[model samples]
Target: MMASNIELEQFYSREVEFPSPLLASHIKTAEREVHTLLAGMRSILRKNIDPSIEELIVQTGSSYEGLKVKGKMELDFMIVLFHPKFIFIPVTSDYSGYCKIKFQQEQLQSEMQSSKKWTSSSPPHSFQYDFTSDGYLIPSEIYKWFQSLADKAVNQNKSKFVRKFVGNLPARTLILNISPGVDICVDLVPAICIDRDLYVVAKPLKTSPDPHLWRLSLSVFEKKILSQHQSSCHLKALKILKYLREHDTRLEETSQFASGICSYHLKTASLHQLAQRPDTPEGLLEHLHQLMDFLIECMQRRELNHFFIGNPSSLAEKAKVPSNITHGERCLNLFDDKFVKESTLNQARERLVKIKGSLPAIIQQHSGPVAYSCNIY
Candidate 1:
């Protein structure tokens, strides 16, 4: 038996939606604390570590998107480097979503020489040791430098509210313990904003052939799209889908798959669905079912394109694309070999089917005289 709309609505209200009062009070407080910590860290980096380096901190990911479900308050921050003396070199077709970066030494030297500003100590620490002899920026070396600076900042931070700080190098993450049993996982990514919509980060996949290749980041554009296009029903459906992906044991078994169905993949699927059919005022269950069907179809076919890659009109009416990036010509497949294995796709398909099948029972089990609080803002 299919779950009734009322049952589904009740389940969503009780389980999926993040409580609004808590979000406004507690989550917002935590967010402010995190921002304060980052501000102090940035100051320490500038004053003590690297005087020439400047960083612009940007919050990204599900938490900022308002797609975060209950019990997960992790935040993502992009520490964007404000160095304009770097050039982005697009990698070969083999690495579609990655690019290699190089220091623009020749251009900088020429310009500085012309202006009589070329001094023996002009080039900063990054331009000196973070690049290879051939001028290509080495990802590992740059990450190491940033990591050391972050470590010093964390140690020097005088905020007694932050109980503990843990630095994860390989994943480029920092875990902060704010209180007992409550920890916020902050991903401090080092990125270079190539354009308004395009950012290349020092993060590389584990199986990447060349570790120096930087992965592309479109978090800012993604946040804009979701904010502009997402309706109440659309946001609820996405939250439920993310909750399922987090709790599904079968999907967890397929963790060996390099990029097995990340939250971004699910967000991409929802965006595609929204593109095909613009969200309406109602039909939460219908939209949820359609999103599941869309994901299953993509898994069966093993092809899900990155939303902004091939589609120029993916952006909203007010959004503008930069002249540097040419959309529609270059497409990135989210389900490629580097992303997911066939076995992982098959398992995810099966798991999604099981979840869809069990929805009725699950909803029925949670159906009771529960107060409906309109708290998803």
Candidate 2:
């Protein structure tokens, strides 16, 4: 008979809580097996140093790195120490994709930092939500785009997508993965307390080697970090850029009635022909431009109506717009050397235009359709 998954999960949980001497022996055995797989790579870990921080350290096994290596090497290992107060939030899961979860998390963290009672006393909390969130579905159309790029990978480009993201410690960082097995559960997860301090608990889970993990990691980290700093603007631009790159001028019609073919003559074409053609690059660009324009205009108008004075730089410098913009006030720029400049506004405008130009010929080939797509974004 085989042990059920639930039974195995329960068994693992008990090893944390009860830790019988017999179970301890089993843990050692598991650690030995894991170490064998590592082949004596120097282990890096974080240890609790204060209420809010875990210190980082690296340790080598009973061996040196420079010697001529031949056979595989193995050494003992241990799970990183964990504090118990924080909830263990898994940032990746087996069932759904990771792109949305990572985006949501970055958005949530940004919001938290902007709140009135922000503090550095607690460990940061992270989580991976189920796939039903609105953010998750927005990017599904791009999955096909990623797949095409993956197929193009050659020996010269294998490491192009991999990068080290953490500032203080060297560790692999990526935001997307398909596997449920990788230990994405944060080590020492943090929880907030009444005194505004934080508590951390549980180490991250270890994962088996899987190509999906690598792919997902690249997608999530890159997407999330870019979205965070660029304030959703860059992501919108990038999406349009990537779309044009993938589809080119080929019309492969999907099964939606609201859709129609790109760059084909309408009067003499059959409904099937119209539906089967690729969507227009011009239409896509127009859609995206409208969105970016709207956002920029709102921000600009808010600034102008508030003070009705100064330049763009001053408005950008303010922590918050004055009561006039929100309360009652042509938008005006309160100028400052650091904040307002003609170049900045031009850059924003140019970004919109540049994204519009980069689409496939099916879009750019026509004027009206390109306008539609740019506006949609």
Candidate 3:
């Protein structure tokens, strides 16, 4: 049976939502400290380490997007780089939502000639050693170089934070111990700014034979689209869905499928729903139902189109990719066969069916008589 609007509202407020006053206060304090650390690191990188390349640190991910749920306080930052001597060529691949990073022939020839015996540990003569003989920028090598520089910067600074490297090799994770039992995890990702709107990150496939591929990042556009929406309920609905996805035990049993379902997928589904129904819903319950239904439909079909790919009229305009970038007009399916297996999709569909069937009971169980809350740290 369907849950009543009142029940859904109570469930969302008591269980899914965090107290904004507390969340905001905690986030603000954390952001201040994080900014200080980043500023110190940026200064060192520019003046002492590498003056040839310019770096801009951009805050991204759900924490900054105001969609973060409880028990997750990690922050994401993109170290957007612009080198006067380097030119990146974004090559579209057969894999949807993924591209390869290549260098222009002239730039490669010049760098190769100048630095014949360049080493990673040596002073920054040029970035020639980070690329392959064929002019392709190796993702792992570049990541390592950036990591080394970040390590040096952290060491030079006399801050009270202890840094560590975690997660995938593409990014560096810094764990800042602010106080007793309060540690903030910051992920610093290195990216090449192709244009004002377009960025190619050094993210590579976990198991792919080729490690030179760079993933396209639409984080800037996503923030713009999400912020432009007038309805607060839309954002609330997305948060509730993310909380459910993170906490659900049925989905957890299918580990592969659950891992495959990223927060971006939920956000994309919500954006599509928002586009379909432009008018703001009357309440949070209505919006949450609409978003869940849309997500289930996407899972059942085993297809979710990337929000920004091939839609030049609407999302593409929002993306603002330069005409010279040359991303093809074909729709890029988020659930490409190369990335997600057929069996995993079948398992995901079945699990979602069961989850939707008992959603009300799940909500009731989670929503206690008193509202649930957590400490920020």
| TM-score result, candidate 1 | 0.81
Report residue 180 deviation for candidate 3 (angstroms): 3.5
Provide the TM-score for each candidate, comma-separated: 0.81, 0.21, 0.81
Name model 3 segments beyond 4 Å from true: 25-55, 104-125, 161-163, 206-208, 230-232, 249-257, 280-283, 313-327, 367-377
Candidate 2 least-lDDT 10 residues:
368-377
RMSD of every prediction? 6.1, 25.1, 4.4
List the global CA lDDT of all models: 0.66, 0.25, 0.66
> lDDT score of model 3?
0.66
> What digit string (tens of lDDT, one per residue) describes model 3 on residues 30-53?
566556655665666543224233
Clashing residue pair totals per candidate (backbone < 3 A):
0, 51, 0
Better of 1 and 2 by TM-score: 1
TM-score for candidate 2, residues paired by index: 0.21
Q: Which consecutive 10 residues in model 1 have the weakest lDDT in total? A: 368-377
* Candidate 3 TM-score versus the reference: 0.81
RMSD of 3: 4.4
Show where candidate 2 strays beyond 4 Å. 1-48, 52-238, 241-286, 295-342, 354-377
Model 1 Cα lDDT, one tens digit per residue, 329-358 = 377888887778788788778777777778
Q: Rank the candidates by lDDT, best first.
A: 1, 3, 2
> For residues 96-192, what per-residue lDDT tens digits would candidate 2 score against the true structure?
1111212222476575676565467854433222111333221222222222222232222333222211111112112111123211110111111
Name model 1 segments beyond 4 Å from true. Answer: 26-55, 106-126, 131-133, 166-171, 250-259, 280-282, 314-318, 323-329, 363-377
